[model samples]
Target chain A: MSTNNEIEKLRESEERYRTMIEMACDAIFVVDAESGSVCEVNQSGLIMTGLAIEEIVGRPVWELFPEDERDRGRELFDTAVREERGRRTSMHFVRPDGGRVTLDVTTALMRLSGRKIVVQVCRDATERDEFERQQARLSQYYERLLDSLPVGLGIRAAINATPKIEFENQTLKRMFDTAACKGSGITWDACRADMDEQPRIAITDDGSYAEERRLANGQTFLYTISYVRDLLDQWCEVTIVQDFTRRRQLEDDLEQVNRTLEARVQERTRELEEKQTQLAQAEKMASLGSLVAGVAHEINTPLGALTSNNDLFIRAIVRLKKLLDTSEVTSDAAMKERFDRILDSIDEVTSVNKTAGERIKNIVNSLRSFARLDRSEKDRVDIRDGLESTLTLVSHELKNRVEVVRRYGDIPPINCFPNQINQVFMNLLVNASHAIKDKGVITIRTALEGGWVVVEISDTGSGIPKDVLPKIFDPGFTTKGSGVGTGLGLSIVHQIIQDHGGKILVTSKPGEGTTFRIELPAR
Target chain B: MTASSNTDAGRSGTIVIVDDEEMVLTSLRSFLTLETDYEVQSFLSAKEALQYIGANDIDVVMSDYLMPEMDGISFLAEVKKIRPEVPRIILTGYADKENAIKAINDVGLFQYIEKPWDNDDLLIILRNGMEKQRLMKKLQQKIEEINRAYGELEGLHKEIVKTFV
Candidate 1:
């Protein structure tokens, strides 16, 4: 009975220790210094070291460490066992996969029922180590993204009625003439863009664009600012700055081109209007002149006979009066003394009638010639004749105000429509006469230029202002204030010459005088 | 030059003047009395002159154009109807080319004159004008008298008609 009880108890103790070892998830082992071996290991030890109990039953515990760390590990284990002091150490734990696990090992001396041994407990730390490394990598990635962005970015706080820069990127710090972003910060509106007061750009905030402005220094930058509610829903502004000076210069050039186009359109409109009015005026004046000429020719034919009859009638009456006077003064004294008076009266009446008739003939001849203008109508005639006729027609208006200094060139009849050409001359002469608001000299000259017939008229009148010179030919553009300017006189002159394929030039100086030069295509 | 030379020929004539305007009439009367030798008879309108033409001896006729009812062209046409041999002259202030051509071709008017005429030219034209009128009237009168003298020829024609019948 004693033998049976003793055997049973031994078996139970062994079973209890084995159960403890199997349930533990860490490696459990025993090191025997005298044998230089591991006496036992737990389930985790078997799986971690990739060995079965038979494969490692007596192997040296130091072998679990790499060759480089084995001696140090062994010394540590020996000190912990001899001193009866527990110790913890980390060691390289090799695995079946040919990789390694780091082991956090605990060792202490312990006595089993009949033996003394050192116990080591190792926990695998690889999983915790990997988790920590992953966290470190994530942090580094975030830092790099923040530092490398190109836009000059700045974060500012909106407080105290101004923006205060809280943070600025490297680029933002370099701009704004500051080592750090300062100045209660800059508002979206206050900050200049392209170095201008209004900077236009695309932004993420509610307002996407701003206008471009120029700064006094001439340096340029474009800034865009966005205001957002962050995670805490606090208002914050992010400003982005870019330089757009070159684009603004291009826009300015584009504006200048638009202005030039507008000016050209206006000029073309004026020129066309002038042409239309001039053509109408030319048609009217020509028809009127022709009608007058025809009338004068018809009158000349009949006046020729009527005056001759009048001459004969006057002679007959005079002869009759002379016969009566002879009878009144007869030598017979029987005649009354009053007969002398009657005879005197009859002679006086005849003489008066004769003189008056002669005067009537002169008035009629002048009127007929005035209409005929034959001297002007006939080619190769003297220009003086046309000028005189024009003077006669407008003589009532001229009287004393205008002093005409006509420097008549040997104006050969270069091929021309005499009546029509005379009209041009008349209009210019009249305009020169009218130009003088007061008394002034009008110099009219005509001559032959090379391959061209030139007519020049000058007036010592109120000259066109310098700025008005370019606009003189423009219809409805005149210096004769208010309703004074028909404004079409010079414009008509300009077109008539042009219709003749001639060129007209005007030279004027303010307060000095004006000269009109005409070049006609010579026939 | 041709016109002046032709007009210088005659030294004496009885000239009849016609016009509406008193100034023209008086001045013309005085001018003829002073400047040329001719017996003067003056009337304002063609109606007044028509009476003189029948009874009074007149050497020439000169009329103004554009009278209210009787224009110079129409008056000359009427005178031609009365005596085709009459030398009539028309005076006008207007060109009136259409009317002038009408007068010359249709009425056989002697002349078309525009106003404001030369004095010497007028006298020369009248001298020629008077001679033309005298010759036309004498020839016309002789033809009439010959026709009157030859009326028995028509009686002879009636006798011949009865014989033919």
Candidate 2:
């Protein structure tokens, strides 16, 4: 009764094993050890080979492999029986329709019904192998794309605890000395140590780090380091390097060009200002020339009448003297009295004419010295001469309205163009006189400083405003009303003084007064 | 002085002077009258001087170059028309010397004198001008007398020819 129960239990166990094998996702094969023939196969194995169970049951297992892989399949089957276990390997199986499929196979030694056999299990690996090959191709494409770029690119991957150089593009290798970089592996610490002398590392707002390095070869490079997740979600360090030498050279050249252009613009502006000043001076000279002609006519008219009167006096005196010397006229008291009355009248007339002649002479002399038309060359002249003549010329403008006070100093003569210097004095004196509205005083002071002759002209009249003071020496800057001033006086004065290697300065108060100070070289 | 004395002894005529300025006329008249025996007539207006010249005999006419009514050139030109034998002189200022000189030939002027002339030079010019006028008058009188004498001689020849026939 116990033996019958044991047989029934064994049959049930066999059926359970068969059901488990048929339900498995992988294909299962049972091979005879001695004959290397297929003894059993699962439904998955039959479906994988596209063969009937009858055709595969007694056939050699190596026959199911492709013709080229049959030998390796047979050796693996024999090794499984001899070694009792076999490693997993990939093998190609041929279907009866001549199609092929890749499979991952594992074998083990087994004993069934007192016979030694091999049990092999294989899984369809076609899709998995194709996916892995695609992954490899994509990785190689990415590396080639990085190597084609001008900018150097590299990657360091952390494995376990140490960072290892996982990838480096061709550009990154060419940018640095490969032999030196190999000796000291590329790491953040190693790079920092390399730039110890001039360490420049900047952390950006985005948490990326950037560094600039100048090598011993005078090559400049910029590096940007970033951390990112790679394909397998592992932490990686990415570095990008760029050469900056050409960009720096271009910037320097542009700066040099800009400086030269700025200098040229300033020089051109100065030349244009000089030309404008010369044109104004020529206009002034033309007006003065016409004035000279009018003055000449004025002098001639008075001169003609005075000369005739002088001759008349000479004749009258001689005739009267002759009459007085006559004996007949001396004896007659009546004749003598009449003669004396005529002599008295003649004496009064001569005195009046003498005064008029003196006036004409003085005016002619003043005009001659003021213009200095005869002296075309430079002359050593006292400054007082110019001041006096300028005072004479501007006296008509200042008379009755203004009073002038002169404070002269003892100074050596100066070598200069007397006419231009005289014009400067005239312009300043006239300007001073015009400053007075109803009544004021003009004070002219002169002194001798070291190597310079200083002349100060001050007016006690309406003064220039502080805002208008700085632009007073610029041409066409005028405070006077229209048609009253030409506005070129101060600028002309400045130009003439500068030509003589001298200086002019002015100080003014709004309501108090204004003063013009001039310094001329005493050479 | 010697030239003045010489002119004073021989020169005598009615000298007419015209000027806008009274002082100029007075000065010129005084110098001429005191130094020469010639009779001097002074007028301020050129028109008035022309009237006087037309009525009387004058040896020389002197006029100032600038005047209100007429310039010296035009006034002298009028004088030449009235008395063709009179010598005209222009007195001008230095400023008007150029214009005066240009008008001298146009007006048949004997000379132009700049203002404030020297007394001796004035006397010499007047004496020479008067001599030229005197010679012109003498020449005209001699030509008239020769014509009359020739007419009488021609009448006598006609009468003698009638008696001989």
Candidate 3:
């Protein structure tokens, strides 16, 4: 009765072991240790090999493997048996349908029922291997992408309160000289210590900041550091370094070009202003030339008549002397009468010549004062003198149509360019003369007031119109007939007054008259 | 030449002077009357002088340029039409010298004298002009005598040809 009870318990325990083996996810095999053949296989083992129980059980374990993997399988089995220990290896099996599967096999030597056997546990490793290979390829591609960037990139992390260079791209290695940085561990703080000047860094609440640093090797760099979470979910700093030397140089070059262009434009403007002044001066000279010609003709007319009369006087005297020397004057009454007539003729000639001489002297004096050619430089001169000379110069134009009345006052001389002042007066006087149609009167008045010499020239003629008054001093503005006046005259007058530090004003009534008032500094 | 001898030698022709200035006319008349025996006639207007030249036999005509009635060149050109043999001289201001020189070529004038001229130069010019007038008259007389002699000779030749025929 005791032997039957023990046999029933043993069978029950064996059946339970068989059921557990069949329910396992991994394949299980029991091989004969001496023959190196598969003596038993679980349900998973058959499924893994794609073979039936008959095909797998009692077969050589090396034969269950592919042709190329049979040697490796046999070697694993032999090692397990000879060492009387367990062995782990990877092996491939070929199914009857020519399909392949990879497995991780762990073998152990055991004695069951006094027979030596190998227990093999195998798990399919194909999916895990493929996942590991894809992971490796992706890692390689990411590294290459970072290396190709223009800006140097680096990652730093504080592991256990100590900063470490987690990763650095190829560009960052080249920029920081990885060989030299090896001694310092290639941290940003270490690189700052190598610089000539330490830059100030300000980080915001976002844990990202940028700074410019000048290295001891004469390189300028911009560092942008950003704090980001890495793949391991740890915070790290990413630094992007850009060289700023070339950009700064280009900016400086552009500023210099701008400065040079402004200078050239200013020089060209100055040249154009000089040319305009020269043109106005040429116009003034041309008008003066014509006035000189008229003056020369005026002087020559009297000079010719006086010279001829003087010659006749000399001849009459010579004849009278001849008669006296011959002693024929006392003897003949006719000769005495002829002598008296000759003396009378001489007297007449003397009187006419004296008038002509005075006329010549006045004309020459007026011309000299009008031009003031020798006194072009600034001098202390009476404004009245300039006015008087200018009046004389334009007297021919004013002779028939315009009458001039002078109201002189006791005024002091002023410091000025006398020639230029005279020119201004001449232009005004001529313009005043031209304003009249048939007959009119011009009044000139001078006075001294508050350290200024004031001159007023008024004409009773056709005055300037209201519409044309504002533009009278603009260059190339004219009211006179085309052949009669140059438009630059009044503009030149205004310029000359400004140069002398003087002021000019005008008032006009279209039909009644026009008046020009000038105030010059008395210095 | 001695003044007396020069006056005696030039005692023949008539010199007519025209100018707008009375002073110029007076001065010229006095000088001509005192220095030479020739008749000196002066006029303030070129028109009156032109009329005088047409009516009388004048030796020389002197005019002033820049006159109001007629310019010296135009007056002289008129004188040329009436009495083409008359030697015409122009007295001009210095400023008008260029125009006077141009007119000299245009009008076939004797000479142009600038204003304020030397008295000696004037005398020389006047003397040469009168001498030209005298020579021209002498040539005209000689030509007239030759014509009279030729006419007589032609008449003699005709008589001899009649006798021979």
In terms of DockQ, the best-performing candidate is 3
lDDT of 2 by residue, A186-249 (tens): 3322554554348468998888898877544344567788999998999898888776557646
TM per prediction: 0.46, 0.55, 0.48
Interface RMSD of each: 8.0, 4.7, 4.8
Chain B superposition TM-score per model = 0.71, 0.92, 0.93
TM-score ranking from best candidate downward: 2, 3, 1
**Model 3 alpha-carbon drift over 4 Å, by segment:** A1-43, A54-125, A142-227, A235-250, A294-523, B1-165
* Predictions' DockQ, in order: 0.18, 0.14, 0.24
* Native-referenced DockQ of model 2: 0.14
DockQ of 3: 0.24
Evaluate residue A94 in candidate 1 and report its C-alpha lDDT on the 0 to 100 scale: 72
Q: After aligning candidate 2 to the native by TM-score, how far in Å is the CA of B64 from where it should be?
A: 13
Best model number under TM-score: 2
Query: What's the lDDT for candidate 1?
Result: 0.67
**Which residues of candidate 1, in runs, are more than 4 Å off?**
A1-384, A414-419, A437-439, B1-23, B33-59, B95-109, B135-165
RMSD of 2: 11.0
lDDT string for model 1 (A365-428, tens) is 4443444433333355444565565656655566788887878776555554455555666767
